[model samples]
Target: METAQRQQQATPGAFTAFARFVLCGGGVGLASSFAVAALASWIPWALANAVITVASTLLATELHARFTFGAGGRATWRQHAQSAGSAAIAYAVTCMAMFVLQQLVAAPGAVLEQVVYLSASALTGVARFAVLRLVVFARTRSQATAHAPRPVPATVARAPRPVPAPVARATAPATPAALCPAA
Candidate 1:
């Protein structure tokens, strides 16, 4: 019964976390797309994308740790490295999408480019959310157990050994009635 109640409570928390993930991570991704587009005018498009990807990944990891995953504090170096691994995958996905778009249309308009880039980002964002939740920000089993009360096994939880009744004074005879009181 208690386990069911806890699972029910967790369902809403997971949903809330996903919603925040979209808001925070998606917002950073959206801004990065525009930033990439602008920077591409000054540098090669691939170079611009690489620069923006690194910056946005750092920002998004911090936001996800602080808010989306309820990680309770700033992201650790290990978490950042794990996050960067997933972000690298997302970057590859976006780059491939853009490369494909370029191959398909010689002169793709800015709107078409944005649409393709955003679509690719949204897809990778879902995957990144899973990776972040399950890997980068997940609480270790030891950490979880440290905070939670451990349940005793049924055998270990058996009623405490029945305490022996007090013996009568040596001078007085001990009666059965005195030694074992009626329930």
Candidate 2:
């Protein structure tokens, strides 16, 4: 609790996390590129790219949530969902950026692809971490902290009243038809 308060007090600009993400993203990108290049002959570049992305993504997410962002194991399934959703949005932006930087701007072909990818990775990492840390995970904690269902006042709770056992009503016996004509 005290540590969190201190952190909030000492909060650096938001850009710091992004800068860290960019640097960390460099590391992740190197690993991912190797993973892709190694598997290139066997798999399509895009498919291998996706595989590497998912793996590096999980690694970066864990690092950012725990060490970078001072989050405490906050990247759970819901956190990943929000982060991944945000990353999807970021990917669109990344694609657009890559298109502009690579095709439109006539950036170098060979290494530029990786550089552009790293740029996009940095963007995606920063955006997704913020969403995961503050929006999704923080909201979960905030939900627990705020608006918690208050215990009902003991006075307001009515003691359970014993329900009476259902009585089985006696049914009247039906008289048989005077005589069975068929018999």
Candidate 3:
């Protein structure tokens, strides 16, 4: 019964993490859309999208690490690589969505472009979460076993810190400067 209880307790909850993830993803999508739109006047939409996609993916990964996964310290480059993989897939999907929207919706406005990117992000969110939770941040079986809480003795005394000794200071003798003759 206690083992079963421990098993139940060890399982990570979803609702809070999912909510944060969605919010972070939405913010990334909005920022990416604005970036793309801002650059569109100076550059082609494809180039703009590529640049913003890379930037947003990095931003989103960091945000998700802190807000969504509660694994800020634990998140590593490998986990980031995993997140990047998801971002790559998401970027491809967003580009396709944009292409389709351009064909179907004439003269897409700022609002329309944002909406399209957000829709794509919403579609990709599930896959991103799955990879982050199951692959990137997942604990090994040994780690899980090791992490199980053990009973500690209530009366254990804490260790005391050692005191430091004062040291004698040594001073260097000053050297006199030679006077220069008038030039």
RMSD of each: 10.3, 13.6, 20.5
Ranking by TM-score: 1, 3, 2
TM-score quality measure for candidate 1: 0.75
Candidate 1 at residue 60, lDDT? 94
Best by TM-score: 1
What lDDT score is found at residue 93 in candidate 3? Answer: 89
lDDT (0 to 1) per candidate: 0.83, 0.62, 0.74
Candidate 2 lDDT, 1-183, residue by residue in tens: 454454453333457656665566567767876676577559865566667667776777666665555454546776666666675676566557655775566535657766776677666766675775568556534544344355566767778999999999977556555344446
- Model 1 bad stretches (over 4 Å): 1-12, 140-145, 151-183
Give lDDT: candidate 1, residue 121: 95
Q: Rank the candidates by lDDT, best first.
A: 1, 3, 2
Q: What's the residue-level lDDT of 71 in candidate 3? A: 55
lDDT of 1 by residue, 81-130 (tens): 99999989988998999999999999999999999999999999999888
Q: Could you estimate the TM-score for every candidate?
A: 0.75, 0.54, 0.66
Candidate 1's C-alpha lDDT?
A: 0.83
